[model samples]
Target: MASGADPKFEAELRRGVVQLVALDYLETPRYGYDLVRLLGAAGFPVEEGTLYPILRRFEKQGILSSRWDTEGARPRKYYELSAEGRAQKNAMLGAWAQVRDATDEALKRSMEAGQVGSPDGAEEETTS
Candidate 1:
């Protein structure tokens, strides 16, 4: 078994963060492949299956606007953030910061109390 954090938990974490990262990228217009390349280069390798559905959903929700470019050999659809998208992205970023800070504080408290890997870990659970 691989040691360290659970892969499933890590993937769930990544999935939550990807929305913010994708929205940040869409601040400027880009096509699907461009997003894949840029995100991959940035160490966030997103799959087409994952990315396209997000783009389409955002477009459908009016958070993103799309235009077609037929000037090239093949037509491509480009996506950009709409006004509402920018506002939503900002709100999401702020909420993310709060969550990150809270998690950090909780971890710090756990470490200080020497409860990080305690056998009775469930006793530390709290409903917020």
Candidate 2:
């Protein structure tokens, strides 16, 4: 983002990517704080509030599971992908790859043709 990037668009973009990024990071068990720090460092900043709800939703949906790890100073709930989660992750990643490739091709065609406003890569017709 440069000096004048649209915040609304940026927020929407981040929202779209959050699930994929969160799932990717949950490849290993991580506590709430750990996940927040890691995601922030990885450029997907998330609040504990935001993260907890998603974690709960994913748990209910059976894509993730959590357990208390009491080995530390305090008991921390750690979350990791379930068997179903792993499969979903792989499927999501694959679908993402297809989307990225398709978007790249569209952009390439746009750049080559130097047109805008539609997928047909044509300039709009003028009205009388």
Candidate 3:
């Protein structure tokens, strides 16, 4: 019932994967802006306002650690994954893989049954 640009669907999808992607990038120390650039380059496209809060939450949860870097003209907080963060990332990745496989299987079945879009983008019906 929703269109392609449905805000609710977009929010739900992003919320589900943001943490996993963030953790993946935090494997290396990076500042907030750097994360925005890197993640955007990787097709994530997270805004600074969205990312900083997530970083803070991860830090509070002991999944990330941060240090102040003053080497540049301005100071920045660099974040890296903690030991626990690495373990959590691995677990999340495994769970994501399972979810992806299950969803793909369900979609394939739906398409085969003509309950959804066909390979040519046409709606199909099953005859009894």
RMSD of 2: 4.0
The C-alpha lDDT values of all candidates are 0.87, 0.84, 0.87
| Candidate 2 lDDT by residue in tens digits, 1-128 | 23366977877767757888999899999888898998888878878888888889989999999999899899999999999999998998898899889999998877765644455646553457
Query: Which of candidates 2 and 3 is the stronger one according to lDDT?
Result: 3
Evaluated against the true structure, the overall lDDT of model 2 is 0.84
lDDT of 1 by residue, 20-52 (tens): 899999999999999999987876777999888
TM-scores, all candidates, are 0.84, 0.82, 0.83
Which regions of candidate 3 are displaced past 4 Å?
1-5, 115-128
**Which stretch of 10 consecutive residues in model 3 shows the poorest summed lDDT?**
114-123
Model 3 C-alpha RMSD vs. true structure (Å) is: 4.4
Best of the two (2, 3) by TM-score: 3
Clashes of 2: 0
Measured over all alpha carbons after superposition, the RMSD of each candidate to the real structure, in angstroms, is 4.9, 4.0, 4.4
